[model samples]
Target chain A: MAWTAPMIDEVTCGMEVNMYFPAED
Target chain B: MTGAAPAAEAPPIDGSARPFLPRGVRLKFCEVRKSWFLLAPERALKLDQTGVAVLQAVDGERDFDAITAHLAAAFNAPHDRIAADAGRFLAALIARRMVETA
Candidate 1:
């Protein structure tokens, strides 16, 4: 199934995402 | 940007579409098809028949239990692992705004 993914350019294809989770207060 | 963690990578979906369809772990809306689809991205590709099994398992809410069971059975893996993976996908899709929670 093909879909036109709606998102900001940086969040679009081929970008490496780095995530960091902070402590919950 | 302040101290907040960087945004995670996730898929995208229209918020307006949620009411018409309640998505689970594997299913996603196919805007062009006007239908829902099961996404098993290369990150977690299923074997051939498992693909078909995944498709059949997502009919609706009642189908979730069956779907979870099917996933465990098809992958020959532990239930917890299957559950975690499924949860991860669902959470990722939601975070990406690819699927909305209703």
Candidate 2:
């Protein structure tokens, strides 16, 4: 497939929370 | 971190507009910093050091993978984490219309 710029698509809440859990704790 | 503040929504852009975001990446808004931010419509994200790099790399030419790799090498953080974080941020950005999916 051809290359494309990173467009804001899809939501990953698991990943998001995983990333910020430490900071919050 | 200096004069650079967050980007706010513009009428020129077609997308949702709001102040608070819905992404999972948590952030502490530094009121002292006085930053203005705009999430990509349909996208939600919080900018940390890596997120900032992702933003800088965004010339509408690179994908999330590219940004993740760049940040990985630049910060020496785990590749998996960077990719995951980038994915999450990208999701948020998409939701806000700050970026559009290809």
Candidate 2 residue lDDT tens string, B1-102: 223233332333212222222343233343544432233332234454545556665554555566667777877778776665556555555545455544
Off by over 4 Å in 2: A1-25, B1-36, B39-46
Best by lDDT: 2
Residue A14 CA displacement from its true place in model 2, Å = 30
| Per-model TM-score versus the true fold | 0.37, 0.45
Per-residue C-alpha lDDT of model 1 across residues B1-102, encoded as one tens digit per residue: 222122244443222222112332354343544444333321111122333344454454433445556677766777665544444443444554443443
Q: Give the runs in model 1 whose Cα sits over 4 Å from its true position.
A: A1-25, B1-56
Docking quality level of the chain pair in candidate 2: incorrect
Where is the poorest 10-residue window by lDDT in model 1 chain B? Answer: B40-49
